[model samples]
Target: MEIEYQYHFSLPRSVVWKYIKNERVLKNALPGCRSFSMVSNNIYKAEMDIHIGPIQDLFTLEIRLDEDQAPSLIELHIKGNGNMGQLNGQALLMLKENQGTTMLSCKANGQVTGALGLAGKRILDSSANKGLENFFQILEKEIKRRIYELKRRNR
Candidate 1:
């Protein structure tokens, strides 16, 4: 499956970058995340509970951030397995600054294996497609609220 998402933040690219790199923020904003911890620099171990239709499972995912470009671009490679299936994806993200704000965009491609894959390609694709839309909206709102609080503190 493939997905693309974009969000605009009323903050500088630097501030937005910090949130993306911070483990706590990432964990909290990530949809379905139960626990996420930094395993090594730029690598994180994540535990999440997700459901598609009536099937639900907990997955332990290993996520790596690559293509270091501070405040500008990033690549996320994730792999995981659960009782339901195996999941793997690569997401390329770009951050651009306009005025004093930032626009973040991501393009991702991945696959599902095992039982989850049996959901039929259309079902899997639609689930992921709809999920990304909802996830991005929620994530952007969380970060925006955080940034607003930070900006308030700076005053």
Candidate 2:
């Protein structure tokens, strides 16, 4: 399946890029993301719960951040399995300054198996879209909140 989304952040591109590259920041962005800790230089152990239609799964994601251009572009690769199936994808991210904010465009392509694959194509598409939307919403909120908190501390 192919999934894509675009969003604008209330921060500069450089600052947003730097903040997003951190595993700790990512952990906070996900909904019900209990914990995400870096196990090595580019490997992380992440746990998150996601739902689609009548199906839900607590996903344990092993993520590896590869091919970094640092504060410019990056590739996020994930590999793991859960109640749904083996989930793997590479998210290609490009950030640009839009007006005074940062605009992020991501293209995600991945697949599913097991019970989720048995659900059908329509279910897969809708589920993927909704899951990604929820993820972005939570992620964006966390980013803004953290930045706000950081500024408050500095003040």
Candidate 3:
């Protein structure tokens, strides 16, 4: 399956990029996340409880930053297993700056095997889309708060 998303942030590209690279910040963006921590450089471990349709699972995922190009681009690989099944995916993220705002775009592809896979494609797509939207909403608020703090500190 393929997933795509785009978001706009009022912060500058550099600030958004720097803040987003932190594993802690990323963890806070996930919906129903239980725990997220770094294992080594560019490698992260995350646990999340995700619900789709009538099923729910506690997933343990290994996330890796496959490629990074500063404030411009990043690529990620993720693999995980849960009571429902297993999932693996790769995503590419790009950022563009116009004036003071930043535009972020992401493209992801993944496969599922197990009970979760049995949920059907339409259900998976809608569930994933809703999850992504929720994640972005929380992330945007966090980023704006950070920007506000930084500006206040600089004053």
User: What's the TM-score of every candidate structure?
Assistant: 0.86, 0.88, 0.93
Tens digit of lDDT per residue, candidate 3, span 1-155? 89998888777889888877777778888998999999998899999998999989999999998556777898999999999999999999898998998998989999998999999999998998898888877887887777788899999
On the 0 to 100 scale, the lDDT of residue 123 in model 3 is: 94
Per-model lDDT: 0.84, 0.79, 0.88
The CA lDDT at 8 in model 1 is: 77
Query: Which is better, 2 or 3, measured by lDDT?
Result: 3
Over 4-77, each residue of candidate 2 has an lDDT whose tens digit, in order, gives 88877778887787767677778878777878999998788998776766878888988887746766677889
Instruction: Look at candidate 3 and tell me the lDDT of residue 69.
Output: 78
Sort by TM-score, top down from the best: 3, 2, 1
RMSD (Cα, Å) of model 2: 1.8
Tell me the lDDT of model 1 at 5.
77
Which whole-number lDDT from 0 to 100 does residue 12 have in model 1? 81
RMSD of each: 2.1, 1.8, 1.5
